[model samples]
Target chain A: MKQYDVVVIGAGPAGLAAACEAYQNGAGKILVVERDKEPGGILNQCIHNGFGLHYFKEELTGPEYAGRFIEMLNNTNAELMLDTMVLAVTEDRKISMINPRDGYFTVQAGAVVLAMGCRERTRGAIGIPGTRPAGVFTAGAAQRYVNIEGYMVGKKVVILGSGDIGLIMARRMTLEGAKVAACVELMPYSNGLNRNIVQCLNDYGIPLYLSHTITEIRGKRRVEGVVVSRVDGGGKPVPGTERFFDCDTVLLSVGLIPENELSRSAGIALDPRTKGPVVYENMETSIPGIFASGNVVHVHDLVDFVTAESQRAGAAAADFCRRKEQPGGEPAVAIESGENVGCTVPQHIRPDRIDQYAEVFFRVGRVFSNSEIEVASGGRVLSVFKREHMAPGEMERIVIPKKFLENASGGAVTVSAKEAKEN
Target chain B: MTHLICIICPKGCHLNVDEQNGYAVTGNGCPRGAEYGKKELTNPTRVLTSTVKIKGGLHRRCPVKTDRAIPKGLMFDAMKLLNGVELSAPVRRGDVVLADLLGTGANLVVTKSM
Candidate 1:
């Protein structure tokens, strides 16, 4: 059995950044295991730009962003294991893994970081009423086929769900000489970034149908066409509002759920809202000495946020390895999502573990203009952050100053978004 | 007035460009938005990204992008140029595949090394 101070899973953006940060933070004998043949993970197929604007302060493509981190990891002494899959992770920090060369092996890790990332929701997950068709694919699958495999997925397409991936693929398929008929979304508002909507859909003269969904997919062996219908406020299809589209492919980009089977096997407490592990301010999971970050913790819109979050997990894992014991800290103050807020990361925070402030990341339940985020404790307002615009598609962050946390009288803090008052 | 969303960054500031007033822009959070609003209505451009054929490499396709934004009207022509391109392995990032694409003053360069 091999032994390591820290073991990071999935050599994607999260794993790559975490391993490098761990190495730099005085963690010795660190190991990064990846199931893919290459090191960049999903970024290898995401060849689009608009990444690394916040982290590197320069605009870079997905592969370029991952390449920079891979280069950084190559300069470190941390070992990387490619073409390897982790089977199970025991609560004791024992990782069971398999590879062609290594066969089946186990490694003892002082601390573990879960960064397996997330997977795209498939047609089966959404239960789309359609014949088993060959031309239907998830937006991400089409992306891999076109960008990496050099294969065009379709000629005439009707895309369901206007997430970022679907919007991007709409342009990509068009650039490849394919005709994208329409991008349909169930929600009244798009789930993707505003920039994507303008650049990918509006730029190409493609129509976007909001509050609409595919009622039926008409095809036998291959995708032939689809029937789209408007949905009411309750998301039920409105009768006599169906429109048919003649197409060859239907791309689904509904949502992404974090891959956390290994974490569940380790008996880690999972958060229903995030479908990831419940974590502390330091990214430590319910199990001591085990941490998680990146999309494995929650699906992030931007890769830059993943890098920042994973670096914190990496640094914390390194500290855990060095201490070799869980340090006693003050009681954790739980975080609650209030009105208009969907969810909050780092479900709780310990005063002693935090530095000057604790950063809380969240998303709104709906869109609002001239809004203010209020952080309250014990029925008293601690702080308020103003925003010109707030939307469910964009993630928001607020920092709780240490002084405010010290002044909190309640055992938990509530964060909410409300319309700003007119002066 | 022409309305446009600034794609300069993720902020996506909505700008109203007054074409009659020398293309002055409002509702912009930054100078980039103002410039973008002005240019978008006059001569729109975009940074095109796509993949091309590759041989003797780890993957069959190599991702590439234009070094700068090209005229939006020339996007399809720029993509057509890649259809005839096929590169061998050992290609490095930032290596130019085509220079001054369609006279747009932007070079097509490889984004990922293969």
Candidate 2:
């Protein structure tokens, strides 16, 4: 079996960034295994702009944003094995992989970084009660067809979710001369970024039906139309408010689930909420020398955040390779979600580990205006962050000063949101 | 008065622009919001990213985008112009498909190699 200092799974934005960071951080023999025929991952299928506005400090398309990283990858000696699928990953840092060229092989690694990214939630997950049809497609699948294969999905389309991909596709299909009837959402507010809503839907004069869902897909072979109805607070359909749209296509963008099959097989602890591997301050998983980042850990609102985060995990994995830290014996506190906060990433943090500050990213369970996010250790508030608006669509972060952790009384840390109390 | 979401970043600051008062901006999180508010109300523009036909490539299409933002009004025409273009394989990233497209001073460039 061949051996490497570090092995990163999935050469998407996360893997690429992580691999590059590990190599730069002085980890030798870094290998990036990718299942796709090429790098850049899903970004290649996403041709719309508005990416990298934070990382690159410029508005760029997905390809442009990913191209920058691919260009950077060229400058590094990190090896990328394209079209190679990792069949299994072991807890002790061994990976079983296969490719048409290499047949099958097992490679040992000093450290492993999981960056498998995520997959879109299909119609089955949401259990949209309907007849099977040809025109039903996931938003990502339709994106690949239109943007990459240059094939239009349908002439008239109705999207089932207000996710960023669905909203962006609504605009893409419209630009490609297809008529997008409506973008329906179960939640009252869109799950996509505000900018996407304004530019992709509002700019194109497309109607967005919030608090609505596709109750039934009406079609025989290809789609003919759909029955959209408003949903009550409990998400049950409100029958009388059914609206029908005659369309050939129904794109589902319900949600994204972190691909953590390999993580489970590796026996790494998983976070129930994020559906990804649980990690500590350094992004190291329950099993030492194994780290996870990006969508493989939790879905991020922006790819730029994935890039930034994976880099940190990459650097930490490199440090793990050099230091060869033992698995999980250190004193740490579990950081959990509370009140309005949906879930927090890096489910645990080792106090006084000394990284300047610890960044905990999470999403709110719902929309909150005029609110403040409070980070509490035990029963006492350590820090409070004020925001004008917070929504489930956007990922929020609150930095915990090292000082607070250094002074912590050694208990679980919880992040919660509340309406600002009048002084 | 017009309210706009600054697309400059994920912060998505909401800006209210008084068009009659030199596009005075409010509710911005950063300096870029002011500029976005003014330009959005005056002459809205956007970066066009899409796929163009490609020959002799593994895939039938190669992704392309405007090297810079162009007037939003010209997006349809710009897309129409690309419909007439067909490039062969070996098209490198940043390669110009159309220079100074639609006289907007922004080149339509390939964002990836074919």
Candidate 3:
């Protein structure tokens, strides 16, 4: 049984950043395992730009962003294993993996970072009522086919669910000489970023139909068309509002789910909202020495945020390896979502383990204008942050200073959003 | 007045451009948004990203992007240029495939090494 100071799973932006940060923080004998033949993971297939705005401070394509991190990891002494798949991860930090070169092996790690990332929600996951057809694919699958495999998925298309990927593909398909008829969304508002909506849809003259869904896919062996219908406020399809689109393909981009089979098998507690492992401020899971970060914790819109988060997990994992003990023995301050807030990361905070402030990331329940986000403890407001516009599509963050929690009475803090009062 | 969303950043500030008043912009979060509003009304430009055919590489397609934004109307013509390009393996990132793309003074550069 081989032993390592730290073992990071997946070679995406998250794992690459975590391994590099851990190495920089003095962790020794680090190993990064990836199932793919190459590094960079999904970013390799994401050929578009609009990444690395926050971290690299330059607008770069997905491959370029991941390339920078790959360069950094190559500069470190950490080992990288490509074309390897992890079989199981035990609660005691034992990792079982297999590869063509290694066959089968187990390794013991002083600390493990779960950065398996996330997967796209497919047609089966959404359960769209349609005929089993050959012309249907997840937006990501089509993206991989067109960008990486050098194949065109369709010539005429109708995209369901206005997520960022769907919006991006609308423009991508158009640029590739494909006619994008429409982009349909069940929700009243798009789940993608506003910039994507404008640059991808409006720029290409593709029609976007909000509060609509594909009720039926009309095709036998290959897709010939689709029937889209308007949905009511309850998200149910309304009668007499069905519209048909003549197309050869349909792309679904509903949502993303954090891949957490290994975490669940390890008996790590999972959050219902995030469908990922629950973690503290330092990204440590319930099991000591088991840290999780990036999309394995929650779906993030930006790779830059994922890089920042994985760096924190990496630094903490290195510290754990050095201390060789459990985290601080202080009662963790529970963080809860309140009115108009969907969910929050770092479900709790250990005051003694934190520095000056703890950054709480969350999303709003709906679109809000002139809104105020308030953090409260013991029925008293601790901090208030104002925003000109807030939307469910965009993740929000607020930092809580240590001074506010020093004398706090309750052991929990609530984060809520409300309309700002007019002066 | 024309209402437009500033696609310069993720913030997506809503800007109202008064074309009648020399494209005076309002409701922008930064100077870039104001500049974007003016340029968008005058001559919109976009940095196009796409994949071109590659030979003897890890992948069949290599990703590329324009070094600088080009005129938006020339996107299709620029893509047409990519259709005729087939690069060999061992291409490095930042290597220019085409210089002064479509006379827009922007070079088509590889975004990933193949």
Native interface contact recovery, all models: 0.80, 0.67, 0.82
Q: Per-residue lDDT tens digits of candidate 2, residues A339-412?
A: 98887887888875646888899998888898999988768989899988999899998898877777667657
Cα shift from native, residue B108, model 1 (Å): 1.0
**lDDT, candidate 1, B5-113, per-residue tens:** 8898888998999999999999999888888999999999899999989999988999999999998999898888899999999999899999988888899999988
Measured with DockQ on alpha carbons, how good is candidate 1? 0.87
Top lDDT model: 3
Provide the TM-score, chain A, model 3: 0.99
Better by TM-score, candidate 2 or 1: 1
Chain B, per-candidate TM-score: 0.97, 0.93, 0.97
The residue pairs that clash in candidate 2, if any, are none
Give the 10-residue window scoring lowest on summed lDDT in candidate 1 chain A: A324-333
Which residue pairs collide in model 1, if any? none
Listed per model, the TM-scores of chain A against the true chain A are: 0.99, 0.98, 0.99
Model no. 2, DockQ: 0.73
Model 1 Cα shift for residue B78 (angstroms): 0.7
Q: Native-vs-model 1 lDDT?
A: 0.93
> In model 3, which runs have C-alpha deviations exceeding 4 angstroms?
none
For A1-423, candidate 3 gives per-residue lDDT tens digits of 999999999999999999999999999899999999899999998999999888988899999998888899999999999999999999999999999997999999999999999999988998889798899999999999999999999999999999999999999999999999999999999999999999999999999999999999988999999999999999999999999999999999999999999999999999999999999999999898999999999999888899999999999999999995564678888889999997799998888888899998999999999999999988999989999999888999899997776656678889999999899
